[model samples]
Target: MANIKKGDLVQVISGPTQARGGDRGKQGKVIEVLKAEDRVVVEGVNFVTKHVRVGQTQRGTKTGGIETHEAPIHVSNVQLVDPKSKKPTRVGFREDKVTKDGVTKTVRVRYAKKSGEDL
Candidate 1:
C-alpha cells in the first residue's frame, strides 16, 4: 500500500539535510514517486547539482553547468500534510459505504489520523 502518492503535500521529517536541519519541517508537493526505490521527489526539496556540457537540445539551447534539481527523498522521511491543521499527519484507511446500481459496497478511503478528515 502506497501511503504517499503524487501531488501529495508532504513535510520532511528527516533526511540528508538533517545535518544542517535545513529540510526539516519543510513542506512541498510531491512531484514524483519512485515505488521501487521507496523514494519521492518533492518540489523545492532535496536539491542536487550536476555538471553538463552546453549544447543544443530538443527543448532549446542547452546551457549546462552545475544544474540543480530536486532529488528523491525516502518516503519514510516525510509525512503527509494535514489539510485541516496544515501539519504533518499520519494516514489511515477507512471503508465508506456507497450504493450503485442497487448494490451497496464499501470502498477504502484515505483519511488524516490527526483530524480524521478525508485526504
Candidate 2:
C-alpha cells in the first residue's frame, strides 16, 4: 500500500505543476493510486489526450473525438496538504513501539511539520 492512499488530498510540488501553476496548484484530491510506478492521479490536474465519445449511446449522434483528461504524477512529486495551514507539507510517520503479551510491535501515525500537528 502507498504511504499515501486514494482519497487523501494533496498538492503537486514538482513537474509541470509548481509555484507557476498558482491556484491550479493550490489543492487537488487524490482519485487514483498507482503503487508500482509510484504515481497518483489528482482529480483535476495533469491533463492528457484521450479518445472519447461525445455521447456513448446518442442513437445517431456523431461520436466525439479525442479529449484531454488528468494524467498521473509520481508520488514523490506530491505532498500531503496541511489542513490548518493550507500549504503543501511533508508527512512523517511516528511509530510507538510497545510490548504487549511479551510481543513487540510498532504503531505508525502521520504528522505534519509546518504546524507540528499529528494528522
**Residue 104's lDDT in candidate 2:** 98
Could you give candidate 2's per-residue lDDT for residues 1-119 as a string of tens digits?
24678898898766553556532464689999988888999887787899876765557767779988888887887888887788777777788888999999987777766744544
lDDT of 1: 0.88
lDDT score at residue 30, model 1, on the 0-100 scale: 99
**Per-model TM-score versus the true fold:** 0.83, 0.68
Runs of candidate 2 with Cα error greater than 4 angstroms are: 16-24, 53-64, 96-106, 115-119
Return the clash pairs for model 1, or none.
none
lDDT of each: 0.88, 0.76
